[model samples]
Target: MITEEYLMQKLSRTMSEKLLRHARGVADTAEKLAKKYGTDPFKARIAGLLHDIARDFDDNEMLQRAKKYNLTVSEYGFAMPLLLHGPVAAVMAREDYGINDQEILNAIALHTVGSEYMSQLDKIIFVADKIEPNRKHAGVEGIRRQANVNLEAALLSCFDESIRYVLKMGFLLHPTSVKARNSLLVDQGSFRK
Candidate 1:
């Protein structure tokens, strides 16, 4: 039940200009992807705009807020509380913005690490977050192109990109991400399960 004007007002007042810019970019990207994928563009935009509502919070704050929001954090989330931002913000979108749409909320929640079973809307937001104009990385343009053509292809690319980055950075690859990528691979019948 949130309007674009209201969402922008809340985000701008609390978030840094940098985060706001990223949010806007994600919103635009999500909307475009949603339209292309036959999902609701308004819902996608709302989810995208609020996806990172808690991204800037400090690590401890993320942990605390995760509990306050009643999100059960995994060991991975406890170790890397940044992962909790998505879920925390999903709750914020519900409690603060009065958004009761589970689909939009799930898209926001899983945008960080991804889930094994993702809807088209979830795939759209995840891909949009990575391919948004504000994002910069190796092969992002190619991934963006893939997103416009195929959501699952774009999702696989995004997952591969994330895995590569995590390996390069020596970070533990979250299991959810692994399962998500594997789910797609299995569905394609290309990987031995």
Candidate 2:
């Protein structure tokens, strides 16, 4: 098993200072949510810490990394390679970091643009990345508060904010995010409570 120290050292070497802080914040928040939701706190922390491991890559580097890992990219991913960082980091966390745990990898991969029927660890990482202490936004507090009550509701709230930000900034809306929202709202009946 890879120790937290090893992961932290790798993160320190690979990420910029600002990103390193964000990763720590996400890990802290993920662990807290994991405990509250009765998931594995260790897995949550590891996924959160390594979720942004590939975030510093430039466009070319991002593509090369994806190719190296045989990870497919959509047209939007090619246009905005930053979005592929989650997938790329997932690959790295497996091959480079010797993380063979599927739950951790899935959480890291889906953290950026979530997928349908996300596992508890996946939801924890996603919400943690969005509502971590370093993050400041209009609806973060609401999501943070909701997180304590309902994990799925917090995910829905976070996705709503993310979609709004994408529209406001004129960024391409990834279909995965839309599907994630739809699944939470419609398929999962997440808001029924």
Predicted structure with the largest lDDT when compared to the true one: 2
- Report lDDT (CA) for all predictions: 0.92, 0.93
The residue-by-residue lDDT of candidate 1 on 1-193, one tens digit each, is 4699998988889899999999999999999999998999999999989999999999999999988877899999988899888899999989988889999999999999999999999999999999999888999999998988878989999999999999999987899999999999988787864
Task: Tell me the deviation in Å of residue 85 in model 1.
Answer: 0.8
Candidate 1 accuracy as TM-score: 0.97
Candidate 2 regions with alpha-carbon error over 4 angstroms: 188-193
Structure candidate 2, residue pairs in collision: none
* Model 1 residue pairs with clashes: none
Q: Write the per-residue lDDT of candidate 2 for residues 1-193, one digit (tens) a residue.
A: 7899999998888889999999999999999999999999999999989999999999999999999899999998998899999999999999889999999999999999999878989999999999999999998999999999999889999999999999999999999999889888885564565
Please provide TM-scores, in order, for all candidate models, with all chains considered together.
Answer: 0.97, 0.95
